[model samples]
Target: MGGGAWKRGGSSCRPTTTAVGEPVVLPTVTVEDVRRVGLPPSTANLQPAGGHVVLNVPVNVYAQAAPVTRQVEVLGFPVTIRATPEAFTWTFGDGGALGPTADPGAPYPAMSTTHTYTRPGTYPITLTTTYSAEYAIAGLPFQPVDGTVDVSAPAATVTAHEGTTVLVR
Candidate 1:
C-alpha cells in the first residue's frame, strides 16, 4: 500500500487541501455523469434529400455538432458539465463504416465524409458521436473528464438506385 491521498471507491471527485489546512472538494464528472445529463445526439443527414442516391456514387454524410452543458449534483455538490463532440463514426449499413475521427463532415461542395454503395438497395445510415466532457464546480476552472461518451443518432434509411445508360438525341 502506498502512502498518499486516499480516495473513496467509485467517487470521481478529488479532495484537495488549501494552504491553510482547509480541505476543498471538487467534483469530478465521469462518463456516466455526462450520460445522466441527457445530452442530445447529433442529427444525421444525407445529401439529395428523400434518402435517394445513385448507385456506385459517393454519397455525402454529415452530423450536426454542438456542445451541451447542464447542472447536476455530484457528491452533494452542484456541478456543471459540458459535453462536446470530439469524434464520429458512420455506419453505412453494408458492412461498411467510417472511423472514429474528429471530422464531423460537411455538405456538398465540401464532402468531408462520404461513402459509395456498390449495389442498389435500401440501407440505413447511422452516426455515432463521441463526446468529451469538462466539469466546473464553485466558480473554479473546468476540469477534463477522464473518459468519453458515445451516443448514436436515430438511423436514417437511404435507397440506392441503379441507373441504366440511355441513348440521347
Candidate 2:
C-alpha cells in the first residue's frame, strides 16, 4: 500500500483531503486603551485691578506626536506656532502696556497683556490666537475665546478718633 493511503486488511482507505486557506475561525483584535493627545487648555488667572487688570493667560495648541504643529485662532486672531515662547498680546480698550520685553522661559506657553479700563466699571476681555501654516494637528486655525473680570479700585475706609481733656475727668 502506498504511503498516501492506509490499507485495512484487503481494503484500501483513501487519504483525507482538506481545503488550504486561512483559518475559518480567526481571532479578532479590539481597540484597547484609547488615549487623547491633542486638546488645548483654557486660559485662567483672570482677576481685577484698579481701573485695569493684568491677565496671566495660558495658550497652547493641540499637537499629537513629536514636532506636531497647529494653529489656534482666538477671537478671530490668527497665531502661528514657531515655538511656545512666541505668543500674541491683547489689550482691553487702550492706554495699557505689556510687561518687560524679555524671555520669561518656556514650557508654560503663555502671553502677558495689561488691560486698562478707561472708566471704573465692568468690561469683556477677549483672547485669540493663530497658528503657523505648518500647524495642522489641531482642528481649525481660527477661534475666539474670552473671559470677563471686573476692574474697580478698592473701596476706601475712614475712621475718626475722639480725645478728651482733663476737664472731662
Candidate 3:
C-alpha cells in the first residue's frame, strides 16, 4: 500500500436506490341529489262521459355541483309522452301517430301534455326522467354519466252511488 494499510474484513458493500416523486391524486365524479314534482296530484279517477284525458306533469331538477341535462317520458297503455332536454313529443297507441317534435307552448323546468285515451280502462301510467352530465378530464369531453327515476300512477277505485235507498246486498 502506498498511502495507508488496507483492512481485509472491515466493511461490506451494498446497493442503493432512489425514488422519483410523490404520487398524484386525480379528480373524481360524484352525482348530486335529484328531485321530481308532479301537478294535478298525480291521481285522478273520474267517470268522464267521453273525451280525452289531459295530464300535466311539473318537474323540477337540480344539481349541487354540476349542471345536468335530462330527458323525460310518460309511459302508458294508450299513450306515451316523450321529452328531451330541448323539446318534447307525444305518441298515441303503438304507432307514431302523434309526435317527436318540439312544442313551443310547453312549460320550462316541467313538461305538460294532453293525452287522449280511446277507451275507458284502468291504466298504469309511468313518468320517467333521465339526467346526464358532461365532464372533461384531460381537455377532452368524456362519456356522460346519467341517472333516472320512474313514477307510477296510484291505484284508483270507481263506483256510482245512487240516491237514498242503501243498496247493500
lDDT by residue (tens digit), candidate 3, 22-104: 44232322222112312111222222322223222111111112123432221211211121232223223323222322332
Per-residue lDDT, model 3, residue 105, is 27
Candidate 2 stretches greater than 4 Å from native: 1-44, 48-85, 91-112, 135-169
Tens-place lDDT per residue, model 2, 89-153, is 33333334232223222232332333334344344433332211122112333222222112122
User: Which has the better TM-score: candidate 2, or candidate 3?
Assistant: 3
Question: In candidate 1, how many clashes are counted?
Answer: 0
Q: Estimate, for each residue in 1-169, the C-alpha lDDT of model 1 and write its tens digit.
A: 1123323224443566679977765546666667666678899888878989998789999889899888766666677888899999999998899989899889898988999999989999999999999888765779888889899998999999998767999
* Candidate 1 vs 2: which has more lDDT: 1
Higher-scoring candidate on lDDT, 2 or 3: 3
Q: Candidate 2's error at 10, in angstroms?
A: 78
Give the number of the best model, judged by lDDT: 1
* TM, every model: 0.83, 0.25, 0.28
lDDT of each: 0.82, 0.26, 0.28
Ranking by lDDT: 1, 3, 2
In model 1, where do residues sit more than 4 Å from their true spots?
1-22, 165-169
